[model samples]
Target: MVTKTEETQLDRLENQVDNGGGGAWEYLCLIRKLKVRRSEKVLKHGLSILNDPKKRSSLGSEEWTLYEQVAIAAMDCQSLDVSKDCIRVLQKRFPESKRVGRLEAMLLEAKGSWAEAEKAYSSLLEDNPLDQVVLKRKVAIAKAQGDISGAIDCLNKYLETFMADHDAWRDLAEIYVSLQMYKQAAFCYEELILSQPTVPLYHLAYADVLYTLGGLENLQAAKKYYASTIDLTEGKNTRALLGICLCSSAIGQLAKGRIKDDKESSELQPLAVAALEKDYKQRAPEKLSLLTTALKSLKVSS
Candidate 1:
């Protein structure tokens, strides 16, 4: 039971669709808003119109556009069954559609049908080997299913296919860290740095992975990366600063027995102090709190 205003908006939206002015984004926004307003009747009406191939062909540039609109609307409405049906229909109708298989897999994932989702994604990959989004999703699904090796395999496939993707390298490195494959994670980070030398966060991520791996010999390399991060970012980034402090503190703890009161070992303290001061003045309480904890640890350990 939509209010008059909601009904009027839906009418206007339908007019826009007829006029070829409303796109998938518009339809999705309207559907989401209508759902939030509890205007199920209006949504159902819109979905019916969108699903009507004759009406959809008369209104849109292509029938597949209408299918996408209905599928997205059904997903938004939490109508997983309808969403799956729409995707299946699209898969049959538009076998060559680039997004059909991916959408089907996503629908299956939404329904918590992991095995079916995996099959759908794998089938999609077989059809289109270069679909990076599907590959990334497969990695995430593998990780969620506690199949670390599968995740690694997907990541390796992605790397082999798209060697220059620094972001993918970062993601793969994070996955390696999760699997406690620190050495492999470090190598991934190194590749990421080579691809994107100016990104301080990469260096930080690399250092963090090394810190967790716990061999004192890795400290020098980790500190070098952290130092490069601080230098590249000119000490302005909070994440970079925090990484430097943490790496420095970890290295200091490991070296405490060998070098007492090393000035360079204490360098991280003042940088962390400066970072905290800036965060406090900027009212970034979350960063301030994190830095404060790291600073405290360094103080205790030093």
Candidate 2:
């Protein structure tokens, strides 16, 4: 269902078409093409409209917004020259706009000017300390430059304000994982689980972290979280099943210090192994040898 605002816009587009406003009709078609991710069409139509000095000038104040749109579409189409042309026009028109500053920073980054892009982003942040767009760009620039520590710091700062941003948490966790900082990654996954306990990916990630940081205690926690993942995904999670096998094997190895293994431990290992064997037979027969090797490495009999 089209919303009232979109209906109004469509009505205006129809009126433009009726009045022989070919430019408006073209612009509407360009927007629709963009909506459907037809980047080539956007570049083709946007360039044709932008190439006309009369139509471009006639747009007046609206021209800047059109320039920004065309600039982004051109960038998507790898037409950097056209994109830069649009950006240059916008820079001249909106010299003091922070939004324009961001576009300049993006253009700089796209041009492989890492240092200049970072500087531009920093300048933008200084001008408006709460600029989320600039902050995000700073994080991206840091990551692009292989400054993982700097990217993590920037994301942490962002999360201090936007604590509920799951994507930020996930990004930070992935960076930590890249650096082999499993404990730190686990902390991020913990936050995700605390806030969105029902998300299977968060549970699986947390479980994987705990398993990677393995001691008997951490493995036990990993087993429990992997169980949660399996439950959340209706037991169709192959990775969770494998995690259960590994965790159970590790726990069984640790059980020599105790009088006997716990009841869940006694029950879970057989079930996980059974499920894994069944899945291997049905979906991935070629991987059965690899699965057997992994199970053997964990001292679990297949």
Candidate 3:
């Protein structure tokens, strides 16, 4: 989701300070800004700064932020001892902090101490029932424990309070999909589309789920969503083009002599075929013939 300029900046981040230079704060901040996860590098560069008393002292109050980043990175890298040390520093400095309590709970989660983690999260929630992180952690615990139903319940409860949470909606949708609950999954995707109408991911997901539902109306709706995805992506998305072909073909066969709208679909199918063929030719010339053979087999009428 970064611009080309931001991508260049990301590529340059590793070379910022000899891989252990004085640019640790800038490097970490840039990674945060980009929302990238270079956990091992984060832990390495973070500790390089933290280990040097002079550099660590230079950060003033920002040192605590680095500690939090390093703690999370340590957990990601499976360096539990490093994570513990960082968390200990934070906990000692701010003993009754809810954020620190979350870090402690996350540590327990990493250690597979589910009951303890749950208890910790539960206690944190007692103070602020709508703690979004803690509530999501409960869902994560359910997922980690392979309790799909429990995860669904926790996500549903979370949604009741935080309906605007796109990630939570997405998580719930995926879990439903895994369980072969396409109808329920479709509902989640609809909410996502409603919340972020311009996001092609939600459109694409909604299309796929609708297609899977396998009805004339659903296929038609799926086709419209697929078309929206293509439009939103400016036709650069190969998957959306492929979805168009699949939906058009399905709709054609199912409506062969049954529907009066065959003429409208007939025009759309050829356009989809042309788009797909052009896409394959430009990106994978050798695959063009293979794609052609496959499209011919679909027999999208007209």
Which residue pairs collide, candidate 3? none
Candidate lDDT values, in order: 0.71, 0.81, 0.89
Per-residue lDDT of candidate 2, residues 2-110 (tens digit): 4446667666665665465655535445456434454565566566667888877776776666677778777777788888888888888778888877887788887
Give the TM-score (vs. native) of candidate 2: 0.71
Candidate 3's residue-wise lDDT over 86-144, tens digit each?
A: 99999999999999999999999889899999999999999999899999999999999
Query: Which candidate comes out best when scored by lDDT?
Result: 3
Total backbone collisions, model 2: 0
Note each model's CA RMSD in angstroms.
9.4, 8.4, 2.6
Model 1 — which ten-residue stretch has the worst lDDT?
34-43
Q: By TM-score, highest first, what's the ranking?
A: 3, 2, 1
- Model 2 misplaced regions, further than 4 Å: 1-79, 85-100, 257-259
Candidates arranged by lDDT, highest first: 3, 2, 1
| TM match of model 1 to true structure | 0.61
User: How would you encode candidate 1's per-residue C-alpha lDDT over 191-237 as one tens digit per residue?
Assistant: 98888787777888887777677767677667667677778767766
What's the distance in Å from true for residue 128, model 2? 2.9
The TM-score, computed over Cα atoms with residue i paired to residue i, of candidate 3 is: 0.90
Clashes of 3: 0
